[model samples]
Target: MLRLLALRVLVATGFAVAPAIAADFPPRPVGQNQAGIGQDVNYRIEIAAGPSSLPTVVGPVSRIKDIATIQTARDNQLIGYGLVIGLQGSGDGLRNSPFTEQSIRAMLQNLGIAMEGGQARARNVAAVIVTATLPAFVQSGARIDVSVSSLGDATSLQGGTLVMTPLRAPDGDIYAVAQGPVFISGFSAQGQAETLTKGVPTAGRIPNGAIVERQIEARFNDDEVLTLQLRNPDFSTAIRVTDIINDYTASRFGNRTASEQDSRTILVKRPASVSAARFVAEIENLLVATDTPARVVVDERTGTIVIGQDVKIAQVAVSYGQLTVRITEQPQVVQPAPFSRGETATEPSTVIEADQSGGQVAMLDGPDLQTLVAGLNRIGVKPDGIIAILQGIKSAGALQAELVFQ
Candidate 1:
């Protein structure tokens, strides 16, 4: 019985040792490593050569707003000074912020209040700067949103109302006037000696705060000729657009070169027999094939990597390891001799330590996308790790696609 018990213990020890030895064993493939893993070659081949035509669907003809003339497709910024009133003692102090006081006095004077001096101490109003964008083709009386930010030392703009203020474009033109109740996304509460804030209290937004008072002219087809512009100035896309339009026109009219200043603008000569509006409508509905650049976008802040379907990497081997360094700073004190005039002092002693673990060099034979992903996963690398690996690959000239860091 004693011999049998000893044999059982020896077998258990052998079983425990087997796993540790297996962990250090070199990696081996269960099957032959080859191309076309988890992919159907027959389907891929069919898609590559099958169709050059797009499906026809009924939709609105793309207009100028849907696309842009490259030159006119830009946003305009507007800024103006405004007042936010009705705050419950959360506004700027009159003594600290003189501008707030001046603005309030001016507003009151405009309402026919005759003050002894040109100054007033008010704690219920804040001087704010309003900013907004005047979109293209805005009509008269159209309402738009505006953002209000405190220009003074105001603690918060909560429960405030914006006075009438004119929003001006960069060209010094007053396009819209804003006036509404401000809605602050944050709140503040204060005790006798302390205060707590949840979000930014100095900025707020007013929905539909501005009303447009002027109209910007946007008239197409006024002349016998018009132009169609490409959003992205690609020569290939421009040629394709021209071809698609010409095909729809049945060669009745041909596009002309108006000027050398802009290559995107192609003049459309109106046919003598057809109405210009009808002809323009037919050209906008035409669909053509578009090609995009092969790109891989990485956002380091969010640790996101967006890889385009056409992105391909060249054959390469990647190995990754981590190095951690620890440093400790301990301060020591030295005491002077008893009855000595010298005072005690403190000294700092810094000890820097480093630790490097043995890292396994993962052999990656990335011939295609599937193999590349599998190889990266084997090393326990996630999105953040992949970001670092991609940066390294780009530096080493192993990545083939354009690496864009956003």
Candidate 2:
């Protein structure tokens, strides 16, 4: 009995000692696991510094519209066909790229040469399409950048020269001519049996390659009324814009209708008997505040979320869990007995594994935005994890603001 009692005491001591040893383990460092919280702030505001009001004499207050005219807010697109030459054997093969051969042949024929076989074998020339945008109010002889893309099977356009190409606008009128050396920031190299490449090889750009040949005629001062178009139309924003304009104009000229109608448009009455240019110059200097909606935008691909300041959420409980399923296939071969008239066979052995995380439901009675953010942070979840939680909450009709996912 004495021996038995001693044995029992030793067993109990061993059990307790094992747990005590484990309990004395060191704590993990805080830096071992940490995550950045919240979204980045990317908002900008611009304010004009000038007189806010001006007198109008040409039209009634109701006839005056916004100061920003449509002519100043438009751009023109130009396109042209060109040739890129002087490639290091990277130019399109004439036999494979018929268009390259045809283009070269046509160009040579125009220069008083003809090919009997209807094809030209050239290793230094490539057909390309050039494009550029002529900004509003561009003047003749101004230089503009242009993009050149090979229309053939050329491997690279590096160190190439672009022939003079006439760029045409949508109106089918030649407005610019592009001609310069192509600048390609990409390259390719060939090996005995393999090739390596970086960036785009067939596309390139020419800085200041296009010279404006014609100017688009736009007159902002000739109109008696000018229209101000809103980038984003909102009723409340429109009202605020109107009020700001009216206040500024009223101070200078009593009860001017420079701000009228919904915010979508504002009217500015040009000062009668004055040069249209001077009248336009006065109103363009006016300043107005703008507002945006309270919303949240999410890009799932990049795990990015942008939330406006006015976004809010209601009380809710959230639980996050992860499930993993793994499948492995092992192939096996079965050989028929030697001398037997049976063929060998193959089979696949499949193994499946499933794991479920130990998750706990968290109760959140968030009364404000700070509380909501804190509650979410306590779960130690990632952006993707939070996305699912937010989606669930929205489906349950708990989230207050709009949830837009892209």
Candidate 3:
């Protein structure tokens, strides 16, 4: 009895001290505090309530590199015409693809072999388009992967080797040379009356197949300002990112360094005392509370629906039902009695039926996505029905969110 009384007194004292401490603490900035900015974000965090209970809520924190990227460090697309050789009778026909014959003749002539013939008709060569992406700051002699696709009517490109093809950028300047054995993820086989194929045989890839012949001159270190492009453009997210970056830079380097240029772009001034790469590395690792707009994305083709947590509806009554129609064909043939002269015939019979599901009206005062979905589900609505209802709600100006259809 004495110990219980002492515990009660200690608990009361703890409760009395909590409010005093809470009142003295300063308020954090909007996005800098927990349960701010990204209330509807996808990331989750589990709060330790007790040993047996684990409840999760949406987390707002995200790294700079995960949400944004340096604008100048982008990939360049390079494409070229090439030929795949050494295929076992599974190549483009000379009569069908005249370009193949022309390319082969030109290649031989370049190699000092004069081809003075009607056509170099070979069933072992296939014309292909070689494509690769030149990475930023790629130096000469570095290798990159290339994709090869049949440019003509070729049966298959299995067991083929790509010839030396100069890959050029959009500016028409050669950047890399691709030549390697093609690696196909598919195979083709044929027997007398049946043929079997898996995956795509005419398209293949070669890992590290292209050797960089020329380097792209990118003076990244010389730039004084670096542009950060957000992967998903949003005004709230951009402002949050700028504030977080400025707060970090000001405390560490003694001045603000980041500013929001637009919803999709943020300009960060590189510090003169630090290298550009090091400064970017530091900025990219900093965490910020990201924000996303409330949206409902629906894919009609796949019957997929994604509802953001911040989505709300303004006191609407939704009524939903389904109409199903089924058609079945059943036929019975009549036979002649005692094998008499009568032609065999089939009778056509089809049964069609229609059903209408009972409609239910549900009043939804959705303050969040979960409540809205639960109310819709309570009315026994399918995904297609829910999509139609969402569209109707948007048209009626009842849904307080953007409705996106894909």
Candidate 3: tens digits of C-alpha lDDT, residues 198-303: 9999999999999999876566787676879999998777777787788788888987877776788787878899999999999999987677788999999999
Clashing pairs in 1: none
**Candidate 1 residue 360 C-alpha distance from true site, Å:** 4.3
Model 2: residue 368 alpha-carbon error in angstroms: 6.7
Top-TM-score candidate index: 3
Q: Candidate 1 residues 1-406, lDDT tens each?
A: 0000001111342321111100111211223222224643221101112122544423233443344352222345667888899999989898998878777777878999866854566788998999988676568899999999998888899999999999865444677899999998888899999999989889999999999876455433333455467675544444545545555555545432121113354445556666656766656666655444557899999988887545666656677767779989999999999999988999999999887653656766555556767777887777988898888877888777789998
Superposed by TM-score, candidate 2 places the C-alpha of residue 203 at a distance from the truth, in angstroms, of: 2.8
Error of 2 at 383 (Å): 3.1
Q: Please estimate how well model 2 matches the true structure, expressed as its whole-model Cα lDDT.
A: 0.67
RMSD list, candidates in order? 25.3, 26.9, 19.8
Error of 1 at 257 (Å): 10
Residue 155 in candidate 3, Cα distance off native in Å: 3.1
| Better structure of 2 and 3 per lDDT | 3
lDDT winner among the candidates? 3
TM-score of every model versus the real structure: 0.66, 0.69, 0.76
